[model samples]
Target: MKPSFTFSSNSIRLSYVSWICIFIVLLITISLLPIIWRGLEDFNPSDDYRLPYELSYDYWMFSCWCKYACSNYPIVMIGDSVVWGQYVGLKETLPYYLNELEKTNQNYPLCANLGVDGIHPSAMLGLIKYYGKSISNKHVILHLNLLWMSSKKHDLSDTEEFRFNHPRLVPQFYPKIPSYKAKFPQRANIIVERYVPFSSWVSHLRLNYYENMDIGNWTMQYPYRNPFNAITFQIPYPEDKPHSEPISWIERGMTKQDFPWVSIDESFQWDSFKKVIKLLQSRKNKVFVIIGPFNPYILTDESLNRYKAMKKDMENWLKNEGISYVSPSDLPNEFYADASHPLKVGYEMIAKELVETESFKNWLDK
Candidate 1:
């Protein structure tokens, strides 16, 4: 009956506590300003774990060379990372390179890069759809991944990702080979990549590596990591192995032919492929279907059997269509970035093909 605290006193206590919380938060935020900045700058929609293919600046630089060397024509390169070269800046990537190349080569055409890594079944068509209207002599090159046609046995999803020197990943892209680190050291490097954010310490030091001496006032450098050296992985060219993936999986009974009890997915990836082509054609743009290199694991014994069945379906559909395609098997593995990806050498080979193709000739005339 004698203990009634006034409302004004309680209100004062609450206000004081609220002010203290705000002050503490302000202090913490100020103290961690650098950490916050690093997190913000390095934000990647994808896993960003780090994979070899993702971090291979050398390969990406080569793609730029191809673009710079062939910038005279209306050149458009469309595909996934095989086209994007994610780790490098856009200017340092293939498209930028093409622009530079066109300036130097009177005979070369203006080239464009419309590639997005981890974009398999949908985005390729987007490249042609967007770039088809922007310039003259619309020429587009596509890198087709046959594995996209493989069975759901991979069990990878749009969000899953496998490891590489860095995590070669995409948002809603592909599934990771769980335990990839335990299995592939080079592949699992993202597990412990020394993420030394841009600091005054790094800036004060002179770190420059050169590849060519053609930059005029500014030298052309092929910047490489100190400990993050690149390792070459063997990618199987089409001519190298007709059915590598199947063979590898066959050992695990992925093949249904020998057992004669296989149940196929009854799905043909090319059906959607036709829709993509039509989308590009409707926009009055020509589509250049670039085929990517197939790895030995992609075309094995079981895969051969599957291809035999699928070939007829593809050819029948192509009877009344005009498409442009090229295979790395037509070239050599030295051009590939890894077992399944292409690098600088590969981009050069691709550039050479475009400059020499009949499709390119047609574009030149248009």
Candidate 2:
């Protein structure tokens, strides 16, 4: 004989056993909430890991740019932080400046900035693999910084443990590096991060969100958060700072003996750079490699020589390959935003120079 269950207002009153079951179910749902939220989003664990040049925040910000640019088919610009235009407003960025130039001059195709900070030649390949298909057949202006090739051999490892700061999550494609408690005190932060829905936490925090609450297309801006405090505040430019005064960069110290830069002629980064160029060519994209100007004022004599050599070698390579490029002459330090990145004046100078170039004009007309 089997026992039959019956329900009545009084008879089915909440019992200890029934209440315990309800609590257990609720607890399980709460624990699994973040996991469930993560599964629904566009987040990828393997690509989220940080390298020296790459940061977790950079990937997220770049993803936003990719999503926006993929649908527009604008002329895409690819490169490192200089190209990324860090510490500047979106309006002040290179792509924005180029587009503004296009609007004024009636250029054929508008430029889209797809630059990300800490992007080496190898990482650029990764970005192309992830987002290149979206901009296929479009003209791409690649900012080739010689410093990318000068990375040390040991710095080239994409799989090293300390390269990433985030605690290892269930990887999508690659194996994860373990997170030690000593190193990553907040190893489980991913759970909370993933559990929270984008609408709840991420979207509201964007630079555009602060600019306007409309949640328009251009939501990502220069993340002006305090590195130490994680506080997002407006950047205060000193009133006395002359428009001609260039912002100093900590990396300007790299020109000293402490920072050794070897020739990148035989580097893993060089191979990766070649691979990216080939990949772009295969896709029938017209590639224009632009060599941006460096801050000559801060460079030591040795560093200056290194820069010149790199530039000459690059020119040789481009000449051999029959690639069209715009190599800007050295500019005053006042034109720079930092050690590497350009200010508004500098970016405008680059665009103007490219516009003046017959090769660039020929490429655009085609």
Candidate 3:
């Protein structure tokens, strides 16, 4: 008879260790993958000011920086991430352009950026009522992003492309936004609370002191895709088709019909829009309400036919409200950095239009 040998305890433990190693290796491999492959890699600046999870609060901090920087100036620009340009420095930003133009050609005599990325429109009303006391007499260029119209609360974040990337930095700084989304990843974001790696801290330091300043698009992807100059986007609607891939923000595009007309009697959004207008008029300052540029998604080929049919009704209700609004749809597509965001070229076109407009000239004259 042969003796039956049982497996050794060490053998079982060794097998378990091997499985653990396999799992860890898989995680690392997944994390390093390019965004092109649905990998969970971050495309932030390599050196690190990347708080492990700072993107969420860092944006508002940018707004706070503007609040601090603008105390000396008179004109203020206010809105969402389109105003921030994700990875760009503050000086090369919109306010910086206004400042530079004023210094050279003297366009926006004393303009400053009061823009807050991710700001809600209702919050904007409160902000204007509160912080806008000084700027009331000043001419204001308000970019009424159509995305806000689709929002339930009519706030910027409630719009289609809402993203809450990092929640950890919230409690440390903006407790309000973080508190609302507490159901999000709290424990994971807490990792950022500890010491940020040396490389990460320098990320913010390097970009903040960027030598040139003209290079603006920050959410740019490199390595796989070719070096893109600008990114542009149209508006987003409820999609019947699932997203086949991540958006291509670097491409140039256009939209025929922006702001799909929803009847005031049919829904509350129309009424709320009226409230937003009321809030704008409530201000004592000259308001230059602008219909910012959009990519062509605002109208599908079918939707375009519908928009053309309803153009008369839509215009009568919204366009004739004595608002100094202009749609840059007539401008070239290369003007955008992404859907709805104007790149450097687009900003110049916008500036040119502002200079030419009778309303803008009148406001500047005052």
Candidate 4:
């Protein structure tokens, strides 16, 4: 009753051509993926400046900006790698523990961490100026390590580029220094890189791949939940101490031209340190300082005396200014992953001590 519907030879040929065209198009698209997804690593600032794909200050700044843009976090932690939780996971960081403490205490202060590796007081001063307003009228727990004041590696120049480029709700105030040459992006590059799937995928490969190769743990490829932060679940053992035998405490395994025990007051860092305090006070942000844990194994009799003297000087200064502070005096050697950074147990102890403090409680209550 009806004509049979079937493809003629010419129509069949046309269908085959169409299918081939679609396959070719997909092949071209797949070939362009890497170029289209060229990420942060593609733009190396200089020969000396290496881009960290994971748990970088840039990522932290970006995350904070996203979280705080619409909502505010009452508690913000600021410091260097120690506070950033290097060699640890996002869940093991001090801020994460503090959040746990908040839940345990039945409080509702949302905590945000802005710690980046190698951040000193001068950069911190600049950071506060830029992002302090976001956390204004909230409790600011600032990690004050003497190493920032004492370490030759910690300088304003080290932070110049990172501060200039990292995302912030407020405008960045870059110092007009001769050394600073990188131009600031009109929009937040960090946010752009984060949302783009290709860039983040590349970052995960870089962060996790090299890390596994370094530790001979290639088998444990997907060890972290938050790969953006490069947070790893690898449990470090005592045999895994970075050095074969303990190196000099002051030297910390690296041999630099300048000794570490140099006077903090004489360094230009003191000026930035003072500025950080002044800026926080001016912003009406409650500033609470916590001196991070140092590996006791690094201390010899001589280095111990120098460390104590520095601590005493810092304590006197805080006391005179009536700045509430706590310096943990008894961190054990076993709790350390390196000369300065602590293991999970150490982070837990630090968070526990800070959250239980009357001063921190009073500041939050106020």
Candidate 5:
């Protein structure tokens, strides 16, 4: 025999209402978290500031930075690690040099560095589309690195699973990345984060405070430690130093080799890059493109010929679009850090070339 428990209709209705109230409270709290987090930190970024290297994957923080830059700066330099100055210090980047040049004329239009490491055109498309709403009605200096089209795998045309940077920034499902093996749930979560501030805020906490781990995993790893103790309430600053010693690729033992360059028509990266330009233009951005001064010195003759043909086609397209651009002549071999990235002096030279170019000067004047 078992004891029976019963509830009146009114009592059952009250229980349901209690759960509903609890759910509403939870929803409101989650939505308010991102706002609360923003208030907790005073994020007045300096003129020379780029996104901290560690926070590169934190799109929420990127959004915050982008908004601030858009509001403050008239010119924003957007691209991958090349523009970010991989082998140069914070003050040695292209944007910094551009700003220094601008000082001779006027200081009103300061250039902001919005580059992220390993951000290929595909991820870049997603990044600007979702996180860069504040960039409209501004002057954009967009960099196009040809190294991404130098191979099938680099262009993301290979249909095999492999690791790539900023998976969270790329399209998850529709244009499938055969190499991206994230399961459905993970893909869905990524989509949610793009639209939901709360989800991204949680990710910021995980990245900055919890050793890049989720609360559950962090707890398991630190068994007896209090989870709250993990948060230091301080955002880590990016070191102003270069990631690599400022050395030319030749000095690093890199040799000239034949690259299996992909054609512009078949290039996935090229297509994505065109779309990025269109997206920026649609937002009323005055777009100026800087095609890479790729290290022609490091290319075998055949590879160099193929690269030249590809570059010519790109120039023709830009001309048809009436877009202002500059494909700077390659710097001396000693100026190259690798096939695409420039050394510190290389950045300075590139900036000087840009300011001296008739087209670049015209765009700036406008």
Candidate 6:
């Protein structure tokens, strides 16, 4: 005869409640851990500081940076890798040059670099909306890189799934991206992380300490190594040297090519950029735009003509919106690293032009 074991209804109910209580306690503990850990660190960022290149995808670190910048710096320069100084070092970036130019002036505001690599217009919108809550009532310099509009693929308009940078920062559900191929669970996880401090904190640990691997995989890779040993509590510094040699496009063997430019009226990236402007404005930010000194030396005549027209259309919109903007003249051919990014000397030239512009002066005064 087999012995039958069955739990009573009351016992079953009690066990269910106990499990729920355990979950609640675990959630609270995890959430509080990040707060406590962050408090223990004595993080004091210096001038010309930017997020470490390795931590570019760590939104938690970015959020903490945003709060710090909001508290200390009055001017924040936000954009893609152009603002991030892709072809140059941290001290050679646009924000650093801006700070240097302002240092001689009376009552000059300190500028902070809030740029992220590969963050196009769409991702920029999501980043500001979710992680930049502390960026209110400050002067924000937003860079517009027309390179994203030069092709459907870069603009995220191609009807194909391809990986792009900062996938978690883009819209997860509504207004789907054709190039993004994240599944439902992945998308859901990203959305949850944006709203959950603990998830992002865990991601920060994975990226900065665990060689960008999850605990399960990391443990498997180093079976005998203690996981806690990886947490050295030391933050990495931003790469001080350029990713590539600081040279002109021509020196790099880049020749003139025709770019299939998209119309501004139907461009997804342009639309997203406009939304970014509106978001900043809604937060009472004093927004100033910098239209690219996009290198015309790398464009075919026809492509250059199209680019000029597109630039004109963009200028017209800025004028109509009454937004302060500067479209500086192209730097010397040798100053450009590519069609968009500028070399160290190029950034210095651009900063000089910006500081001398009447519109820029007026915006800064305001």
Residue by residue across 239-284, what tens digits does model 2's lDDT show? Answer: 2222233454543433332224555555555666777888898888
Model 1 misplaced stretches (Cα beyond 4 Å): 1-73, 86-109, 123-137, 153-268, 296-298, 304-316, 331-335
TM-score of each: 0.43, 0.59, 0.49, 0.57, 0.93, 0.93
What candidate 4 gets wrong by more than 4 Å, as runs, is 1-70, 107-110, 151-259
Q: What is the overall TM-score of model 1 with all chains considered together?
A: 0.43
Off by over 4 Å in 6: 1-21, 106-109
| Stretches of model 3 off by over 4 angstroms after superposition | 1-71, 87-92, 105-109, 130-134, 150-274, 304-320
Off by over 4 Å in 2: 1-64, 105-109, 151-246, 249-259
lDDT tens digits, residue span 1-366, model 6? 666986466533558888899999999998899889777555677778888888889888888888989898989999988998899997899999988888987364479999888899999999999989889999999999999899888888888887777889989888988888888999999988989889999998999889999999999999999999888877787879987788889889998979989889978899999999999999999999999979998999999999999989999999999999999888988899988999998899999999999999999899
Off by over 4 Å in 5: 1-14
How much is the lDDT of residue 97 in candidate 6?
90
Give model 4's TM-score versus the native structure.
0.57
* Cα error, candidate 4, residue 202 (Å): 19
The residue pairs found clashing in candidate 5 are none
Instruction: Work out candidate 3's RMSD over C-alphas.
Output: 15.7
Cα misplacement distance, residue 96 of candidate 5 (Å): 0.3
Candidate scoring better on TM-score of 2 and 5: 5
Worst 10-residue lDDT window for candidate 2 reads 45-54
Alpha-carbon RMSD to native, per candidate:
14.4, 10.8, 15.7, 12.8, 2.7, 2.9
Candidate 3 to truth, TM: 0.49
